[model samples]
Target: MKYLSICYIGFISLIFISGGLFIMSINFLLIDFSLFIEWEVVSLNSMSIVMAFLFDWMSLMFMSIVLLISSLVIYYSMEYMSEDKKINRFIMLVLMFVLSMMLLIISPNLISILLGWDGLGLVSYCLVIYFQNIKSYNAGMLTALSNRIGDVALLLAIAWMLNYGSWNYIFYIEMQKMDMEMFIIGGLITLAAMTKSAQIPFSAWLPAAMAAPTPVSALVHSSTLVTAGVYLLIRFNILLADTYLGQFLLFISGLTMFMAGLGANFEFDLKKIIALSTLSQLGLMMSILSMGFYKLAFFHLLAHAFFKALLFMCAGAIIHNMNDNQDIRMMGGLCVHMPMTSSCLNVANLALCGMPFLAGFYSKDLILETVSMSYINMFSFFLFFFSTGLTVCYSLRLVYYTMTGDLNCSSLNVLNDEGWIMLKGMLGLLVMSVLGGCMLNWLIFLTPSMICLPIYLKLLTLFVCLMGGMVGYFVSYVNLFFFNKSLYNNKIVMFIGSMWFMPYLSTYGVIFYPLFLGGYIVKSMDQGWSEYFGSQQLYKSLIKYSQINQIVQNNNLKIYLLLFVLWIIILLSLMLLM
Candidate 1:
């Protein structure tokens, strides 16, 4: 609570405003940043903060992605959230969410970075339960609780680094000097990432997070929050390049990919399906990350961010127009009715399906190619092979359910793409989703491996896509012939999916079973925040505490002064003790 201050908040917003325009300005800003190339001078310049913050193309690009999605979420919330009575607070919280993310992206020291990292975990959980009075909290609760398990692991990893080897992140630039404890810590960090990113057993929270606001669903689940775990892995990738733990992470990642794709195939809700898609893609990225291909993983991150956000928004628009309806069974024949939104959804879907000219193809295909260089690439190759069809199948399901068939029976509100704000954001994102992937050089600082796959691989991927589409079409055709509950239950496919249960089978499992675990989380959260805020209100009312309210609400000078004193003592103590 004390952490929320105006200057801090404003500084974050400006960072977002600046970070949002990151990619657009990166190539152009090289000269502006070139003068600070010397690390000593950069450190001196950073003396203002103690840890010299030097700018790099990679960090800048990451900041922009964080800002761009966050700003758009805020901008879109104007329409999506404006009518809600709590809109102002929601907007403020949203900004805080992004600001924390910005802090994590740019920090030079591990301690500095972890401050932002933990902030993301807390803020994201708050946003997950933003709509305090719904079943959505169940999903939000699950995400919050599961992410915390990962958070605890991450803390241990960070603490281990700080206490042993005199290793500060400032020295990460010199990797060869790190000790055995560093390698051990690196493994723990991957465990943390696996939990954070919804990598396998953790995959369930993402689908459950569908309970949050649609915009949050887009911003957190798709573009940012979920990706932070993977982003952490990428940022620290080179530091742990040759460690065995890194290879162990690759195994977790590969299994997560298969699990996510399978689960999405059977999922029926529009948003959850896309949410599951995010898990699958993150798994693919992690797999690439484990193999030490940072560029491929990061490129997949960018490409997935655009298309995935587009997918989530498309889900939101459908849900919004239907008056909070999310079950696909409740929607149909919407294409002709909501032309603009359906159009945008279609464009994003095309990119997601890796339609050749769209943004997703360039990045996703390159990831597949790069992984194929090693033995494990076979896992990616086949997982994607099946995923190609699953992606097309589930994606087409959203379009099919919303627009293609006769409208289903769920009572719907009068469909309206009423607000220009939502429309403008969707249209703009559609453009970016289509074109953003082609801007590859800026995709990663590293050059990509050339595609050396035999011509048959392209043919194989196409065959996979066609078969998935045909299977879906055939299934749809069979549905008309005879409706049977058993057919909808594909046991063989489910069995293959059980292979992913390796993490789950351990006596102490990483994957929490039962989606309901997340729901209880929501009820607990509401109780806690309610207790905290209610007590604050009661204290103010009884004590003639206007000054207290002013301090809490105004958030200017006094709080920052307190923070300054607190940090002074902490840092001074650290210097003395160490």
Candidate 2:
């Protein structure tokens, strides 16, 4: 009852705040009004420090969406974490997470942004390790360390921004394009964004972070934490677009998208698959932003948040009913047992695939059409469309594995969609997933973007989606001949299945050589040469000198008389010399 009251209070308050923010965002958009509030913190010679917040349409709308999702997630957690002893702690952590995101969204000062950004990292680490298991601890460590790279980069960027006599990056974005120091700042910012978004080399931590609880996954990984990078890039888009750095980012993000989509197709863990898909969509956003389409990226960001959160929540519900089993191979014919969850999952998946009139369709279709119109290289173009198809392939494959076929679990298990609280939470996002795309398109863009393409070019997206669906559906069936063939080519299967060995590379590939060198150094220096020539030698010499002193100081009459005579002779010699 105490936990229920906490949940209800948070849910109701956040919902009210979200509604108010939504209205304010719309008004801001309509009137082209933005409010910037600043407080002077300190002033030094030729430099001043100030904390600032920018309440623009973008930030307001994003905050509204974040709060709305958080409210639903809190409501959902009432039932999800009801049996746990620390449900209140979980709710508080979630609220802290949301507060950090809000700070990041509003802050314009680099210092304040860092505060918010670091808050996000710290809170996410706490959430990831909430399960208090080895897997969760490892995942939390990986997540923290990976994001620390970005935090370091952001710190460097902040230091570099000191050269401009201000940390308000918004004022210097245009000036940055012409200055070398500012350009370096841009590079650092991009690096930070990539680490946060899990682009390419930084991508390994994202799927590994699935050790977090489902509600955490829905709120942090799916919506807020991962999107921080893209949001940073969006804020700094002017510095990157049309530059060498932008082109480099374009390639990297393209590869990231392709890698994530391919990896998702081979993944069996339900949460990890969703995490990879989130990575893929982030890549798409980063790619478009690199091409100077910040609005489109923002559009897709919002749309993706709705559906992805829904997808994660549905997965959580399914996992809950399945006795905490996340392996999709162990799940089948779920549509019969958990029809509401299956229906919501399918809706979210299709929206992810950009089915027409769905939330994803609006932004994804625009992005593909715009990419088709752009004059990018063949490599990137191919990556763009191919990755799109792979998205469908994975979505269909997931649907087939979970929603169709014979029941794969033990018959003794009782499964049903009886969690009404979970269902209500899912239902809210389900509506958004179905309608968010079109609504966002209308709200975000005052004038619609124009795309001029031939019939075949325009139809390419639909064609690839169809083909990918067919492949995904057919590939779900296990044939003995193909299975044997796959077994024969185990190395290839392993490579593709394991995200091209990125997780291993991120873990062992990074630390193996350094650790090995440290071990060698310990053997040769600390234990060997340093011990023998330094500490051991010093100890022996001290012992020898001590023994000599002890012998000289022995209380023997003859030795004492001889030493006194020698001292008298030396004194006489010294007196003669004087």
Tens-place lDDT per residue, model 2, 472-564, is: 888877535666887999998889888889888877765556668889999999999999999999999999999988988888898889889
Model 1 clashing residue pairs (backbone): 136-211, 138-518, 138-519, 142-518, 334-402, 334-403, 335-403
Q: Candidate 2, which segments miss by more than 4 Å at Cα?
A: 41-49, 478-481, 512-578
How well is each residue in 374-474 modelled by candidate 1, as lDDT tens digits? 66645555765676667776666556656777778556468767768788768767887878888744445444346677887756766766677666655
How close is every model to the real structure, measured as TM-score? 0.77, 0.90
Give the worst 10-residue stretch by lDDT in candidate 2: 506-515
Look at candidate 1 and tell me the lDDT of residue 71: 60
The reply for model 1, stretches above 4 Å from the true place, is: 1-16, 19-25, 28-54, 134-137, 163-167, 239-243, 377-380, 410-412, 441-449, 480-578
lDDT of 2 at 425: 97
* True-vs-predicted CA distance for residue 489, candidate 1, Å: 5.1
